[model samples]
Target: MQHIGIAKLGKRTKSLVKRLKAGDIAIIDHVDLDRVTAESLIDAGVEVVINASSFISGRYPNIGPLLMASEGIYLIDAVEEDVFNQIKEGDEIVVRGDKIFHKGKVLASGKTLTVPIIKEKMEEAKKNIGAELEKFATNTLYYMQKEKDLLLEGMKVPESSVNFNGRHTLIVVRGHHYKADLKILRSYIKEVRPILIGVDGGADALLQEGYKPDIIVGDMDSVSDEALNSGAELIVHAYKDGSAPGLERLKKMNLPSKLFNALGTSEDIAMILAYEKGADLIVAVGTHANLVEFLDKGRAGMASTFLVRLKIGEKLVDAKGVSKLYQSRAKISHLIILVFAAFTTTITIIMSSTTIRGILRLIILKIRLYWGF
Candidate 1:
């Protein structure tokens, strides 16, 4: 690209997304960019991404750069560690083949990511992925051996005010395409009124959609203070020995919460909790469902998730990216019916109104008198 506009800077892509407008250049200090971050940048309508860290370190095929490049965004890879420090926010900048400039001076240089390069890197990543998968298997076996109770007998959770018995429970995680998925299930959420459970940052996601979470489950690191106090019942997911760091934060905020010691990720616990509460169905949005996604979340072992599926696969449904399934609008037939109803209501109003009928007759009589008919 010949020229670019103001630079929006943030170390975390998620934090930066709220400020990004269409065509804004994003400068982030992220390494091995995950697909979710790339999707967020794309959704924010950013045209250029300047990374202060490696986009792909050949570490298990991090799909961020590939997704960005494919989406027609210019991605400059790893200019320098000091790129973030050197570039000030709101500075108008120019890009020329991996070089970033301001005031006719080159600020930093790096490699411009291309489709071919991404394919090559992905090939290299495939080789690395094998070893990573092996290690993940080992970790899963180790954790499964230690935490067999979570799957075998089920987890004994603390008493909760929100009941999930015989109800459909929706668990949201601030993961890939969470916003879109939640939007797609809007009708289901409204009609069924599923028990809403927000996992960490997912609580913020629910709040963004104007829905209050019935329960908030997670480590409580990324959720906002407002969400924590939105009257959602809080459950702190602690380690097996019952040490909860997030619990301390809740206490400091004077918020009441229960403790749940589990082995899997918070999202996993959310599912398990709904399952044990006798939920008829569990609909998950933005939760990791595949190996690539689990890797995207930087988790080595999915033992807890594996066991969770084994325990409740019949009742569980993953609705990741469900927004792509349909258009975000009423159907043409539906719109036509709505228009017809409005037209029929107007006609009925006109027919029933004496003033309007008299006005219409008078106007017609006047027209006839004027025409001499």
Candidate 2:
């Protein structure tokens, strides 16, 4: 089948997704693409994907390719490494099987990934998990030695302006269907009104849902300037050498922020910060917890995540989907909202039809007669 679309190219998949439009061809150089990137691209409504790197390097069972293929996305893999240079942005391009043709010229070629092919590759990656685990474990041990002081004793977290003391803290990260989880937690949010913390890009996610974050924590690379100035206290994540590059971004924005120097991911430090500040419960949404997720994020080992979870222990809850079981403890305000909703519905029904109004009156009279009123 010959497929055609306008080309939209970027070296970084996440960055490109922001500018992508529906029906455009996405061109990228992501190696062993991660699920989050795939989800973003799918959300952008692109029909075709062209990758200049190995889509699955067999390093781990990454679900990016599988996600794209299952969603009816055409994935062309291992094209020339310089394919980005060949196709200009907004060029009309056509693909037939593995060949790329533009304006009657053969520009480049690669293998078009299908669902079945992705399934087979994932199976092979599974068989190699044992070796990958060994490497991950070794890396963890190595980093733990170098960063133990920071993880255990040297963690200098500042007093957050947002008081999390004895309160429930919700940390939102833009990972793995976070928007779905957040949508499900809306009611819980309204009732409990937990202290909301957005990790980098997750801050933008919170803004999209019409909630202001109490605290924003991360490396400051992906978060927007508007989010930085959203009145949320910012906590900057720093490197092992006590240098925080994210501080520059904050300074340019002319906003005040505090720095927390640590070795692991920003999300890990965020959890630690909440736990240290006496949060009674920590609910994490869109944060990666499994080995596959770590590998997908290019983490050699999840040492900090491991240590932080052990520290938080009984107070932490990971929500697979928050919409089902999470309900806010109902209060008088909830009753008021419910009653208001019922009143609005009653008024609409009464105005819409005369017969419906008569039925309601008859039911009320019957109740009054039965009560001898």
Candidate 3:
């Protein structure tokens, strides 16, 4: 198949997705492409994806390549690095099979990804997944040992204007199935009215779903300016050394924010902030839970997540994928109550109406006459 489109190149897939438009060719150097990036690419409506690095490194069966393949997106894998230097943004590029062309000159070539090829690579990756798991577990234990005390002893949170005391809090992260999770929680959100917290790009997710986040926590790189300025309390996650890269952007934007210098991911800090602020129940949406999820996030270990969950204990509720397992079915008790209420309302209506009472008395008198009672 032959297709032509404008080339949009970036070393970072996440950053590139923002500028990408439909029918644009996305040139990225993403290795072992994660699901989130693939989803972003798919959402951006790119016509083709050219990667300098391997999409499936045979590491642990990353589902990103498979996801892209399934979506029928043309993927060129393991292309030469010179492709980036040779191509400029907005240059009309042509993809004919495996070769990329710019103005009739061959810029680079790579293998075109197909469903069959991706499936084969996934099979190979799965075969060696045990080794990957061992390495992952070892890294997790190693880091957990060192990081446990900091998380367990309690973390120092920055002052926040939002109050979480005795109220349910919802922390949204732009992780796997986050959209579906949020969709399922619509009723709960309306009824419980939890304080909404969006982590980085998760703020955008909230906005897209017609939600206004009460708190926006992250590096502030992924979130849009509109979200940051949506009257939400901003909290910048910083390194242990007290350096915050995201703070500069907010400062430049003239947006006031509190700095929470801590270790671990931004999602971790968001949860910690709610816990420290005495939130009654903390509900998490689109959080990374399993090994593959952590790997997808490029996290080698779940040290911080494990410790944070432990410290938070039962107060934390992971609402990830709850939509798949359970639905809002009416319970037996609820159904019974509903039926009883309906019956009571019918009887009350009949008793309250004079015409209905007269008709009932006439029917009773006729029955008594017929029976000679």
Best candidate (score: TM-score): 3
In candidate 2, residue 223 scores what lDDT? 84
TM-scores, one per candidate? 0.78, 0.83, 0.87
What TM-score would candidate 3 get against the native? 0.87
In model 2, pairs of residues that clash are none
C-alpha lDDT values of all predictions: 0.88, 0.89, 0.92
Question: For candidate 1, lDDT tens digit of each residue in 296-341?
Answer: 7878778888888888878998898678876767889999999999
Candidate 2: regions farther than 4 A off: 321-373
RMSD of 1: 4.2
Instruction: Please provide, for model 2 over 1-373, each residue's C-alpha lDDT reduced to its tens digit, 9 standing for 90 to 100.
Output: 8889999999877779877999999999999999988988898999999999989989888999999999999989999677877889999999889888899898999998999999999999999899999999999988787767644674678877788889999999988768889988888799999999999989999999999999999989878878998999999998868899899989988899998877789999999899889999999999988888888888899888888887789999987556556655789999999999999998997889989888989999999999999
TM-score winner between 2 and 3, please give it: 3
Write the candidate numbers in order of decreasing TM-score: 3, 2, 1
Give the deviation of candidate 2 from the true structure as CA RMSD.
Answer: 7.3
Error of 2 at 80 (Å): 2.9
How well does candidate 2 match the true structure in TM-score terms? Answer: 0.83
For model 3, the superposed segments whose C-alpha errors exceed 4 Å read: 327-373
Candidate 1 Cα errors over 4 Å, as ranges: 2-12, 15-26, 43-47, 59-61, 70-72, 82-97, 100-107, 123-135, 241-245, 248-252, 324-373
Clashing pairs in 3: none
The CA lDDT at 316 in model 2 is: 92
